[model samples]
Target chain A: MPHPPVHSPTILCTVDVVLLTLTADGLQVALLVRDRAPHAGALALPGGFVRPTEDSGTRDAAARMLREKTGLHSPYLEQLATFSGPDRDPRGWSVSVVYYALVPPMAPDDGAPAAVEWHPVDRLPPLPFDHAEIVRQALARVRSKSQYSSLPVHLCGERFTLPQLKLVYEAVLGERVNQVSFRRRMDELGMLEPMVGETVGGAHRPAQVWRVKEAFRGELSLSERVLAGRD
Target chain B: MPHPPVHSPTILCTVDVVLLTLTADGLQVALLVRDRAPHAGALALPGGFVRPTEDSGTRDAAARMLREKTGLHSPYLEQLATFSGPDRDPRGWSVSVVYYALVPPMAPDDGAPAAVEWHPVDRLPPLPFDHAEIVRQALARVRSKSQYSSLPVHLCGERFTLPQLKLVYEAVLGERVNQVSFRRRMDELGMLEPMVGETVGGAHRPAQVWRVKEAFRGELSLSERVLAGRD
Candidate 1:
């Protein structure tokens, strides 16, 4: 066995959030310009060091970072994976516990004050410190979960017609969905409740508006059958 | 924001492995009696603090601990979740990057001399730290993955008959599986290859034995259709 160093280096701990939202163009990630050293002025994911004195745990730190950096509270937040190594960070050996957050499309007048830049995921510019890989993994996870879950609904606002929700699913899935099957699958999920006296005018007819059930706002409804890509 | 501590305590980093194997009784977890404080003499999962000098990353640390303590090399190991907090450990703030390893049942003389005790997961004794919660999460993850993937096959020897593999799946799932559907599901997975001239005698007939394809030893084959519990 090797003896420990008289003064071993402490590991640097931090949390990074991959905040994703769907737009007219496609899936986009929220990023901010780094305001500190090591990568100052470079665009990067919203992240910060883990403040043990203030954070109850890593999850709390993740939520706090999301709130502080992006100024947007995600309707869905989940721990994706932890990335660590000696060579990943220049300051020292580091471990980053990453979390992915899903929020509905934000209106221009939303109260968030952060200067967040939304970039298409597939056409992202070069990122620093393994953040590009982190975004890729988060995208893969969201897409995979969308195949058999109510995950994509998190990208839709509270009141949406079935066609509107279907578009959100198609945007995340990157494929067309059969209208009939999509309706049937949504019925099976039972995660949405039709809002009484709320209807949206469609090209052919008025469509009933729906909102995710209060019980499932923070949770997901899963299905055994996967949504197949376009035939 | 609060001011930083004059000398803030560093987070104690570690890795804990939940080593699981199926037995005649059902799923069992491997545990070791801690030989040092703060929980000396208490049984807990095989774990240790991360050694940045020798370990490339947290995953490397987990593999090292499993090798040094258990003496059994697992073919299937995956990151389960990270457990972290200030109050979870007695010394100070800590973060445990947890990994779960799946290995086939061992023989009496498997060359492992760690005095390892296998306890049924459902009937585990009191454990130290947040280990009880860690074990629960590991079990839940394994069971969830087993429902739609060839994950339970990790609990079988290299060469096993179909009936034998089915038994392993049943033990992990805690329910009886339909014979016809099980065979069909295995065919869909296509992860097995029949060994030439390898036959095991059974009560009714000679059963042909099969081994997992080399390509799938480190990965799993998944299906969209879930394995339903006992009807």
Candidate 2:
């Protein structure tokens, strides 16, 4: 990192990522036990100090940290908020730009950082520092946007049946969505593309499978209806 | 600002506010001509460095700076986005926590800091550094959120008739809105309260005046219909 003049002004800048995924049980977040000071050995969101010499943006730093700590490459990552204050860190003035990332279900990686684990977001153990509050904010953001966006699709497998996709959305929204209405909204969003030769099997029949359009995978799809709010 | 140990990490931290207000011409932003290095004698958004000792949250710092520099105490302020990169600051690594604030229509303050002025947002002259880019992002955020949120109400007077409020929304949205539907949407939002004793007389019969309910002033009231998009 480049150093400023002898008399300089600087603050600690780091990027913290909330890596969220849908487990068989429910929504979960990746966390790791800190091995360094401030709150050593406490479970916290995976994060690292942003390298000024290398990172051009906080998002790049967040992606790098998630890859290093969790060994998973996420499809959807959006900035949640920036947590900054004099008291947030025991060290001097510090700012942690927080991000929320999403990925499909997968087995734990062999290359994952030691001490890292996935914990149900609702049943998370007490986390270190302000991490617990960070998780709460991330959950609120994801749930709120899920009402009008295709964010929950990131939690589905690469190719998924409509029933499977609807279930993912319901899990994030915590509500029963009508099938016809959900399909209508999906068509309006124009974010899904059918895999012509693909099908997912079930006992009664084989359902046609689809994947999110490449353009919509990393962006939000605004809806005309207020799915969960007063409309 | 406190400095860390000789080899400790540090970055330049600042709080830049996009202070927006309603004007007869259109929405305007508060900007001040720069008087210091890097981009001296150029128009820039009203902002200041974050003081570690006196500031705990970035929002507090933004409010303080807006108060100190623009002579305005904004009622509605929200964190917009963080602009950070190595090249953002010519002097060193910098992170600017940006915020967007709204104020009721009023005459420009005489107490505004020297060199400060209000520029019509749509006809803004070229700004220094990346302030223009910041303004662009701020405008997009404001217009997009206005589609469903009760944000443009800040551009209205303390006591305004339904017609007056509708005009404010239309101006911000850059489109014509149907009166019957606009009123219906406003009622659905439940963010306005009719003033029992107030009326505004115009060419037409006197219309009842309303003010945003206190509870809704600091919160977003969501709606299903898009304010500016095809409806």
Candidate 3:
């Protein structure tokens, strides 16, 4: 008879989110302070175990986790990367599916359950586990995504001025974009339309506000012009 | 005296690669056969344990495993996602970080050490674990990335005809693209330049070949014009 073969060990799985929102201060992200061990009292991304019922599919699990933790329904979410090192967590060898989500800046509802708070991205506190590194990677992905797609709009309110949208893009990309060029590009992409009877007041001028067109909701694609000079 | 709490079992960590290449048969990907218990002898993505190394990162471990399993050297690799579930594997709880890589096609070296083979993307056999899902997600990402950036060039030879380049793009995207539109888009991105002395024999006429410009390396930004549809 052949001898029995040895088998590899099992691993624990979890999902974490880097939820971004544009704020007056700058680009902000939601983080939670762990109230348990392994990284007790340390800042971390909002996450939890993947329930068995939620494991019907890959995207399903991620979506479920996102909604449960953030209270945002079907937000713009993309898989960032996974963090699975032996020492990433002191408990054991665990793997985390990290996702990045873009949401409009708004105060949480009175019934929002998670013990989390939004921190301006530029001033993030040290995070638990390998979360600080995860946040960095997520921001990089957001910056890259903003260049080709209309994802920055997801971080702004429903009705906004072109300058407000431009500021969101600049905040995420960490660069000063030419105002004229930015508006021209947005108009070309059909990302915005003049809001009916809407104006935003500033110091000297009342800027016309615009809302994202419905047709452009799921039509985001990478821009070839931006790719040309990226390298 | 305070009593310590009972801890959960230890989790195992692993890394898997969605190794892709461009071949005469269109896009091809490498798959391995698991020879041990727990999906034994089943087709699977090439992967291995994450060794306890002080210097190597998660991606570094993935690259090392990919190089060891496949004879190809990949210059383009990105972290796809992590798979973790209590019962994903019958053996125990296990988490796997999946990485996607694009490699140029070539015959396997005689000294290559793994029992790996490349299968056309359209005719892939059933894979072990959750590898089939990993491949699907990786392909989707590759297609989306190709639309904005010149990433598909990494899957082609250093110098390739426009027809060959177009075919590669279509295969990854799973769609038929208008040749005139595709050519115009490529030209506007400035990703490729006409080669001085390269021609490929075709039935009717000799097709001119183009080489990817060196200045585009490591520049993965998308074009504003492409998004705006100005070109």
Candidate 4:
């Protein structure tokens, strides 16, 4: 094997995204029904094969598929893991670069493809291929990073009250966080900015809305002791 | 494109491993010199194209490469990230599923093809392709995860004292850790077990040697507030 085999088997290379968004019910994952065979009509992550000529990177391909399926571009997108197994796909040895995309609440209407829908992360329907495992890994990454990083902010809208942010955190973490401690931690993180003229009326009173600081918007930022007791 | 294309581009798929090991000086990474054209004889991470038929997963491929190049199977091998870009490989659009493998102290002797050498992580020479970036990401993940998870323990020998473990952590983290806090955090993690009859002679006294608990041997375990003040 001194000379490498130029005609090595051509394997299928694709990207799958676990697009997560926070809804009134809980954290929902955006999925699309596979229209073609192998698992036709089965709900799958909104993704497609990485076009060798066009895609600069798998991240770009994932972002493109996300935009085409959900009509939204994620503010926070990261590669969750790469799932490549001999038996994972019926089509030869396929490698799927799994990514998790986080977006604010939006109408998942990419038109014509009415199959794109948001399903609660906790109770997803049967997913095709190894998507269930992909989703589980994505959820683990999101939850683990949320403990110390400013990641959950991407799931919130442009403006949100502290209570709303806490709800988003609770949904992702699956635990009730101490309000005062969470607030203190957020304040110490300094990743949020108050929306001066925005206030949402709640049952108790008017709550001021906050947006993630511009510096922390493009990439992830970490804070020490963010989840002190929760972790 | 309702129907998928049957002749999707034959993208080049490969795996690159960042193999880290503890050395007498400090933490070092193993590298191999490429033998073929396009950057022959340049230092590169130990890697090869995924043999689609033989490999069960990218992780298995990476581990095989580790064994072939270094003659040691890593106890802590994980998928760091997938680095794929149009310009990454000169041959074609290539996707490199980068992985990081950690091992205890070992001799990296692969006989005749003695191209593999361990270089200090902090002072690495120029590497081929996007391997430098892969190393950077792997190091960041190791440092970040070591703060909370039982990751650095794998870099130590089978039996090590608390001081030896602290040195391993400091080397991976690039900072000195407080001895008291480190011990307390390790105790809370419950990922280490003392060997009843093992003790290493030190200047002051004989120190009890500990090994990672059996339950947490092959996987990473996390603790709350592991690096309480170090972070």
Candidate 5:
């Protein structure tokens, strides 16, 4: 059989990032106003076209876009999925290698710039292209991973109490996790390191401040059992 | 801050599949010999460049390539990762969206074509390009996911007994899983449905034959607890 003529057209390639954080309101994602056509001035995920001259790979492109656009360095950024199609982009057929980032809560007084907007993930407004679906998948990945891994800890500060960490898990999972079961699972995961002599004020006792172990900062420590939730 | 000039060069995008199956020799991956220049005649993952006019998306491209190249319809095909870089491929800066497919054991008499070679995953030949690393990542993903999901069931046939399914899990995991624990975990995952009036030969008694539920054919049912392994 004769091979079909190779049709390798100029496929538009780009990378988009879903920056997520824990805020007082709840789980929120950072959005930026597009400066170029196709969706100029509309809110969208922070992204840009892949530059072969500069980026070594797609993850490098995602990290560079996150730093340049948000002015925030994420400790946990993962490739969520690659979205592609003919109708997704107006200029031509395109592919967007998407990533989701997690950061600790920003200082309340240090308000974000006008271009960067933090919107609740569940209540995002209409976004351009297939970004809405992208955010939905990112959120689902974060939530599902939070169940069996130490993923939500990225949303906590370098040092945090167990109660604070539990709150972060609840925020990410959107469900109340059983206290005892959470502690047991955390022990099994072995992801936390106690900050020696560090204690924080608590309602009943001085709580020990803990941080994620150095080894598990970039890679998540998975649990053998899922976190039990309060029904 | 000055805006950087956009340099969107043509990125060579393609899709490769790591078709894996269970044989007496262990886990093996399907590979094809390269036919064109730039490592022509070398064994490599079955792949091709994206066709914008034909493929609606990258996944569509992957399905199309699998059908045309392997002559096998994969029931479980999932995107593993997107490998990219300037140095990996000799042609130019490229991106390869990879997917891993699982199949059951084929009859010994029905030998694969000379073009299609099934190499033991652990002991692979020097594959062209970054095909080796792609296979490594695909294998790691399949093994890791097998711990808490019904992913290994895809390596079993349409009708399987509990004992037969356990062996498949052991093969994919490369570890001896406890019989009692394996059965309990499978029950908790709830992916299998009993084929009424069907029984298979067993060591002690006629064992009930089962098949994966229709709902889980495309998706895996995850177990909250990991499959226990004996020391």
Candidate 6:
């Protein structure tokens, strides 16, 4: 007779976050040190188990994980991708629903998780598991999203200068951009509006501050014209 | 005493597919009839367990599962999302990684260990597990991707007419498109070129056939102008 299966079937679910924030240096990501049994003592994306609740869905689970891991509630959170491989975790076969979150940079509390730290995206340390690969994919999606959508605004404060916005894109895409072309594109998209009372500090030519159009909030709609030839 | 903390805990991992194809009626999806074990007899996206492989990564595993289940090869596949909840799989704690795939409208032999059939997206049957919800999310992503990318081309044959191409978009998006606007957008994107030796069969007019542009072959690149809203 054939041997019966050994273990009781179980579903292993967890949430992982790609928390992106804009800093003076450039775009940065928050990473946490794993303190528990699986992958302990390694730098990884902040995440945790999904809790059972009446109103909690996948998005809610992601939000909960973000808050628990980073102590910051981002205004924008979207599902990035899911990662599951038989050998992804040595402990067992676990599947993780990954999310990409955008929030303004903030200081972590003193009592926060001991291993958590903000690392500039370009100079990231070795991440645990497939996290480094996850981050890379998330970054590519973010860069692609920022180009056609108003997502770049999420990386900056409510009030920001054009130069600041340009810098965010440059950092995320890892390249230099032409200011004239970038401004022209922004104007055509109607994504930005000149702020009434703001200007860049400490510059011979004070750059005008602009805010993302409030009416254009939420996810940007993909337009036919934009799809045609606009990047 | 608690069983001395059992070592080498086992977790279940499964692969789910969001198989999309373009047909005359519209975009359709392939679902399989669950025949054995959990969710038996219910219609579900075809899925199976990951096998042990030394060189297989997550993508490779997904591709293998897809090929074995659907008899399709080299289809456009991407990680959609992961569904891992304690109660998601009644058999036990199961973790499933969902992948979205785009295949042209050609019937392939069902190689899965289950009864499989294609159903128009709008008339999908009740699905097993939380698969209906996963399909909905995947469809939404496909629609979004189709708007800005040449992704819909994947739903067509190696060569096709402009009308056939337009119909693919109409079916996937569930909306009628203006002929002039659609053609203009296609031309502007450099997605296709008129074929010299072919003509579409029709009662009223002999329309010219078109092939996907040579330059637009392989994975399409997002244009900076399109990204920056210069159209």
Report the number of the highest-DockQ candidate: 4
Q: Tens-digit lDDT track for model 6 on A1-231?
A: 333463533444567889888888877888887887566788789887655542144567788776666666546888887776556766444557788988766655534454558888889998877888889989988887765556767777778888887777676666776787677657667778898767887778887888777776555533233211223
Model 6 misplaced stretches (Cα beyond 4 Å): A1-14, A34-42, A48-64, A86-94, A108-114, A158-231, B1-12, B37-39, B51-61, B84-94, B107-114, B175-231
* Model 2 lDDT per residue over B134-159, tens place: 98999999988888879998777777
What C-alpha lDDT, on a 0 to 100 scale, does residue B208 get in candidate 4?
94
Winner by lDDT between candidate 5 and candidate 1: 1
Question: Which rank order by TM-score, best down to worst?
Answer: 1, 2, 4, 5, 6, 3
Contacts from the true interface found in each model, as a fraction, amount to 0.42, 0.48, 0.40, 0.64, 0.56, 0.26
Docking class of 1: acceptable
Candidate 5 per-residue lDDT, tens place, A1-231, comes to 333334367788899999999998999999998998777999999999989999999999999898788877545989888888888978777888998999887774444455788999889999999999999999999998999899999999889999999999998888899999888888999999999999989668999999999998888998756785732
What clash pairs does model 4 have?
Answer: none
Position A192, candidate 4: lDDT: 92
Query: What does DockQ give for each predicted structure?
Result: 0.34, 0.49, 0.28, 0.51, 0.39, 0.27
lDDT of 3 at A149: 68
lDDT of 1 by residue, B1-231 (tens): 332322324788889999998888889999999997778899999999888888899998899998889897655899998999988877677889999999988886886665788999999999999999999999989987898899998899889999999888888877888998899889999999999988989768899999999999989999767775532
Q: What is the C-alpha RMSD of each candidate to the true structure, in Å?
A: 4.3, 2.9, 6.2, 3.5, 4.4, 6.2
| Global lDDT of model 1 | 0.87
Angstrom error of the Cα, residue B110, model 2: value is 5.8
How far in Å is the alpha carbon of A59 misplaced in model 4?
0.5
lDDT by residue (tens digit), candidate 4, A1-231: 243435656778999989888888888898888877768888888878999777889999988887777666555888888999778877668899988888887753534256668899889998888999899989988998898777899888778899988888888888888888888878877889999988889768889989888888877767766473563
Worst 10 residues of 2 chain B by lDDT: B1-10
If ranked by DockQ, best first, what sequence of candidates would result? 4, 2, 5, 1, 3, 6
User: Which 10 consecutive residues of model 5 chain A have the lowest summed lDDT?
Assistant: A1-10
Model 5 over residues B124-213: C-alpha lDDT tens digits? 999998999899999999998999899998888899999899988888898899988888888899989999999978668999999999
Compute the lDDT of residue A2 as modeled in candidate 4. Answer: 41
Per-model TM against the reference: 0.94, 0.93, 0.71, 0.92, 0.92, 0.73
Q: Pick by lDDT: which candidate is best? A: 1
Backbone clash pairs for candidate 2 read: A11-B11
Model 5: per-residue Cα lDDT at residue B122? 84
How many Å off is the CA of A71 in candidate 2? 1.7
